[model samples]
Target chain A: MRDDEEMGRITLAQVAQKAGVSISTVSKVLNGRQDVAPPTRIKVERLLETHAYRRTARSSREAPLIEIVFHELDSIWALELIRGVENVAKANQASVVLTESGTRHSPDPDWIEGVLQRRPIGVVLVFSALPQAVKQQLRARSIPFVIIDPAGDPDPDVPSVGSANWTGGLAATRHLIELGHRRIGIITGPEDMLCSLARLDGYRSAMSMAGLETAPELIRFGDFHVEGGYDRAMEMLSLPERPTAVFAGSDLQALGVLEAARVNGLRVPHDLSVVGYDDVQVARWSSPALTTVHQPLRQMAEEAAQMLLRLRTEEPSSTRLELATSLVVRKSTAPPRAD
Target chain B: MRDDEEMGRITLAQVAQKAGVSISTVSKVLNGRQDVAPPTRIKVERLLETHAYRRTARSSREAPLIEIVFHELDSIWALELIRGVENVAKANQASVVLTESGTRHSPDPDWIEGVLQRRPIGVVLVFSALPQAVKQQLRARSIPFVIIDPAGDPDPDVPSVGSANWTGGLAATRHLIELGHRRIGIITGPEDMLCSLARLDGYRSAMSMAGLETAPELIRFGDFHVEGGYDRAMEMLSLPERPTAVFAGSDLQALGVLEAARVNGLRVPHDLSVVGYDDVQVARWSSPALTTVHQPLRQMAEEAAQMLLRLRTEEPSSTRLELATSLVVRKSTAPPRAD
Candidate 1:
């Protein structure tokens, strides 16, 4: 039993080396990415089955299972991630178990122990970090875990899946800039989160490139919800020199900003242009329809689940996977009106 | 060990019978629902713990755990339910384990078997049913389960938690009528769902009570989403004599109705009035802030979680728990005008 456990530690690199194919090629097949040639996909799949032969020798019929741990099921964001994970989970016949981390930035040791007891093939943590103690213990048990949008700085050992926040921020800011808006205000997420910092940095860079000075007062930090967006945008719009345009870090926040605009008697696209990030479900449903940056949260989550599965059953590949972002122009943005 | 296992199966009736208190009084203490006299509460709690003093003899340090099973993690609706369950789960020092039943409405035997293997204290099924075979297996093992908003007829054997949908529909339509609107249109959920039929029935009764002839063309069956709501409302509005007010079965559908109105250049509450159900997070944020029936989905979920915990550890209460719903009049409805 101990020897079989040792064999379970086989890495994705080792499988690729043995199969005489690149690690990426092996990953495409395992993730059901559909980009790989059929023959190569077949060969890689055969090798993966053989590699897990000992484990499946007991029973080939039962589907595999994985675990997804979230810090909180706070918003629509969580639903999008769950949808992505389910898409892949269904196709692979692998179940996803959800457990909340209960507001602690570092997970409770007892919760980690419970996960260890379940012995899921792999674990995916969303907007979460692994404390040193828990990380050491997970490694000792030979269980693979991946982080999605880590709360802190990226650690070399932890694999992660996230969208390009900086690029998204840059695109949103540039859209406002090109539309003849110079006095642009930005509402970013919590300062400590990596994605928040990246988005803030992206906004600063765009302002600098446009030869515009980013006023310190124009930037506000928020919790990425409607209330925070409304509060911060109220302050920005209340200033003696109100910005003609605003960029919000989340769709929820942008809706709040719109509320702020309505309360202040400012018309969207006619008096003020607004841009939101993370084109969540209600963005299109909102009146005037929000123009925003598209963050592929669902696809990113699917990739994360796929990555964790590979790490558990096959071998580890290159650690970080950053999905690209794009700008989606809708009815909410337009050129600032003449004074 | 076997003796302790047997003791674990001790029913709440057995506890109440020994404690010399009514089963309901004992239940109040077990669920921490305050109202019992201090002396009675203390006496019941003591007896409850002493009944299986041996169970605590093993270790009472670890918190108890419960399971919540969902049909699919597809919508904001699911997250609200999760949040409600988590609130009670946290207060009771009980952790929640979430499992998705996927496409199969009635869970597979294997899935039920896997849950049984986990040995959870109780289970909460959201919009799900158990096959007779699986139900028998669960009962034989003494594991308790409750259904929340069951999709089919209310089964006597299965305890369930839900809101008063008929009352909600009545309240919404009555609000429109009292606003001086004689002609009202209704859009309901899927035909097979009990809530759908109830809401539709409620609409018919309200129209009858008003001595108004019900128009078959004005009532439409929808899937309870934006697209369906929009399509049905569009159809109703295009009629030669359109209704002055529309009542949508869900907030999503209301948004669809709003979209239809916008496309047709009708101003809400001025040219027409709209009322929605479910009052999800986005309703308050929508343009004109939707008038809706508060379904209490989150509170209903909390009550369901609390009920499941009680069913497992205490004597079961009367089977079905129906929470009350109310109307939240926002900006979407008003008196009809004389053009």
Candidate 2:
């Protein structure tokens, strides 16, 4: 299975001729050499993409590596994802290369150069979208990649692993409803994220299914942070007819809700019940603990890494895999107080 | 300078000759090939160690990697330290290789083999002690290593980075004392670790300086976890003469203390002031935040990684560098009631 012959597509020689460059020059551009002229590099790159050239599988002597890239390494989800990838890498006798680069949508352009030079076994990205040029470059080198898209937005052609945000939202709302609460408030995440919208929709569906009228004032958008949760919860708590319970969207936001409840002289699970999303470590450490939706973030990372390995060997069974989310009952939620 | 030509040290040829093996076999053993016979490998290893054999520095074309190994990846400290090394790696155009391998004192034998093959620019270990054999293996490969020892126990000869544990403890206790906490309980970390002893000594010194009688019943040893804090705090709160405040040795333990106070129907700060150590992210996320000591974990990691880079080019000025710790006043501590 040689790379140049497998697809029966136009070979590198034809692409080199089309781009008016020597085969060696085309090879230099493919290998990410800095000596190639910028215009010639661009032309060769276009031809490679057009021809869908795939390099042969790397030799066995190459250093075994699995690269994981994240836009924001400070997120609480980072450790779990890293651990998951590390586990698989160890099992395969591969080292894990970590990089915090680029914006939320994709990794920085410079990052691709390092990956090309390293010639890692595969890459696992924690972003929702990747630019076409980046995708083309990775494909041209036969370096497989999979996205761990927690944001619930995935490109149709890309392989991705995500959790069921909508079901999580529904499960959380239903738990509160079952606890005899009718005036329910929700502080969903940022409006731009698809996962946030999905969760919000799930909350609305749950409320409507239970024959409860959701007031527009009870619905608010948060930034998935403690301060955002605090501000939104404070506003909702100050209402003339405050809700008995609130869904704080994320664990950080729920922590803010707990503080807001404390500021208003309300004890958790006694005066007001609160539910959180993403059962991160803090969920268990919070003073009263927290009743949250358990998103399989670590498992998602493992699956994404596994998908990359599978892509290296053969075609994957599916382009997208969505794991289920479940509700965890902790001390934070209970029946509303009878006043 | 070439490795064999430097320092007038014994060369690989001498090592292999003494071990009664071929030069190629000794080279295979150095590169971590698994095909060598166990007896032959052991003999070759001993010869190399006795001679202090060092290989040539890796070629410039080799993959740019900086390795960081941890025995436990779940600690709250992991994220910050990873970020620190990642920051430096990015600036230097190098990628970080992360591994969760080995025990509390040293990495597993299998880990060094991969590190050898990867030929990282250097390694940053998060353990208190490493075996002589592992150290020799790394040195022979010319792979510089530095320890990020928060444990406060470090090998005198190895370059290491650590923070001031004793000072951190003293600062935390002094802050509580200044807030009118005369009878302060202290729950330091596990007894076996030097850091635990140092912090406890600091607490004792602070109490003695303040002319306060250190009650034997008020002092305890914890496991640096939330549950240990909760258990110890619960016991203290149940005492016939409970202290007005408690010094939780770690933020995780401090979280435990807060929960224990809640279970006992005591209000934090108002009824019993609390102070925590190692102001990790959870310290700020905890409700009412936490009045704790900032351990500078990220900075320590950065310094350790930088030390490795320095060792690669030239000798480090010092074998050990200890950063200072300071108290952060949050909402967790306040003056006790005059009742």
Candidate 3:
């Protein structure tokens, strides 16, 4: 499928002809003009919402603008992605326009309508679940989209960029195990997120390899934010036989666990050990420095941008690109104290 | 100046007339269509780049998008501002479109052109120096823009939102003074930044009020970032007779000072006291937490958004808004120990 035909183009003339109205009436309805009759307006409005109207004919003079959609925009994690995308955009002479869905995992119903109106050359979605309906709408308009760290199991046909989350999770747990830790706990991201499930599976794989039963009580689902980590860590720490080491799904969550420990008077490494994912700057800035899995977030974003650019230029490329993750040893993890 | 006239709407016909070509020839040039004479194409393209062609008649059918431009998108500091703007935007049924200047303090020269092409209802600039030419262009297009924490001395005519940095700086320095530290070192933001200068002035005022001579060698200009704090603190700590306390320009800077102390094997509060500005979350997560000034970044952002919205409605309002900052005493400060 070529880029421009993704959302099968809907022309105003066609819409007007189908609605039995003049082009001016259709235009008025589109412009939200008050002069259109209510019934004609409703008919035109529904068509606009349900279909994409291509404006390329009159918009030939505008520069290529790329639209990046985020499930939410409140994260330091986004800074890396923005940097990578902006780097690519500048080199290509394209300007980026950012939109937030406001939801954590999906966009509002009319997001496609707004996106199509702008006629962006390409789109990048971060931590999102692209519903089939939206996907169909995008495909119909020929607007190629690439997902970065998609939140759920993405459709096989979709293009995406991600980190080796399972490997990262495995390495994190294995490091703790090598440090002579057992009874390890894991804080994973939202249950529906594929990366979260992959990380948890890796943890379970590590535990199974060590001949330890996977204890349900030691596993907690988190939102990959500080508060989520804090709340879950608080619960696990209250258990009669709490784990001596914890593997957090993300660095932010890891910081939360550290705070929970502090509140409970447990010194890191001295009384407990902790590991986190993402290895964001905060992980290094943590007092003890955090031992975390570096997800190459910026690299992933660059790759996503490159992939989208290739799609725009009609170059052949792989649909999915999963970058490697590596373990960064700082000071947050150590052997558990003698019992 | 009314919003929408900032770019002074131009049309394809106008470009064609100016280029001495047929309207079709200009339209082809705008669309990147081949077959036009090279010289004629160049003339038409130049006109298009320098002019604003109103797409509002066709774009009015699109949903409202408000543009938010940031000098750089590199820090978690932006999250608070994003949350605040997003909250208000949602309540008012408006969606935000974000852009970054890439330059640390100034927007790209062509930024306003792209923004006007998009026809956003309003714009909000964060830590930016809006050039006079751009301001005139925006005003002519009738586009309203409000600055949030302007990066430099904003033009008097521009509406802006800022924190009471002078007061915040005074409180930070005064707190250290009350803790019985006579020799105090200070770090401020970039040399050209208005906020940075105001903070340094505040520090000087506090020292003068305390009857302590402000030593030139003890002051350093910083960029309100971690690395800046680290390098400056390292130098201050190496002085033969170093000050007993340091006032960091920002929270990230304060963390850098902490790191510096760690490198020199100096225990915080016990050997050196520190105070920071901008009470971001990192301030609370630092080992001893951080004694810092709480700048109302989110509130300032909300206020900026409200101010822009008012401009979009052509309502009269104050041109400058300076919100108060307060001292947040945490664990990073203490009385100097007896030598």
DockQ of each: 0.19, 0.77, 0.33
What Cα-based lDDT does every candidate model obtain? 0.76, 0.89, 0.78
Return whichever of 1 and 2 wins on TM-score: 2
- TM-scores vs. true structure, each candidate: 0.74, 0.96, 0.77
| Best model number under DockQ | 2
List the TM-score for candidate 1's chain B: 0.80
List, residue by residue over A109-165, the lDDT tens digit for candidate 3. Answer: 666666666666788888556676566556545577888873435546678888788
Give the higher-DockQ candidate: 1 or 3: 3
TM-score of chain A of each: 0.79, 0.94, 0.81
Model 1 Cα RMSD, Å? 14.1
Q: Model 3 Cα displacement at A228 (Å)?
A: 3.9
User: Chain B, TM-score, each prediction?
Assistant: 0.80, 0.94, 0.81
Q: With candidate 2 superimposed using the best TM-score fit, by how many Å does residue B139's alpha carbon deviate from the native?
A: 1.4
Error of 2 at B169 (Å): 0.7
Model 2 Cα lDDT, one tens digit per residue, A1-339: 986467557677988899998999988887777798988988888777666677765678656899999999989889999988988888888889999999999999888888888888899999988888788777766678998998899888788899999999999999999999999999999999999999999999999999999999999999999999999999999999999999999999999999899889888888999999999999999989999999999899898888877777685343889999999999999999888
Model 3 docking grade = acceptable
Stretches of candidate 2 off by over 4 Å are A1-6, A9-14, A37-39, A50-52, A316-318, B1-6, B9-11, B37-43, B46-54, B316-318
Ranking by DockQ: 2, 3, 1
lDDT tens readout by residue for model 1, B1-339? 786686675666776787787888766554344477867756665565445422211124333557777777765478888778878876775666666674535654445645544455677777544566555545544567787773334656678888888888899988898898888999998887888888888888888898888899999999887889899999999999999999999898898898788778787878889999998888988877899999887887888887877765575544887888899999899999888
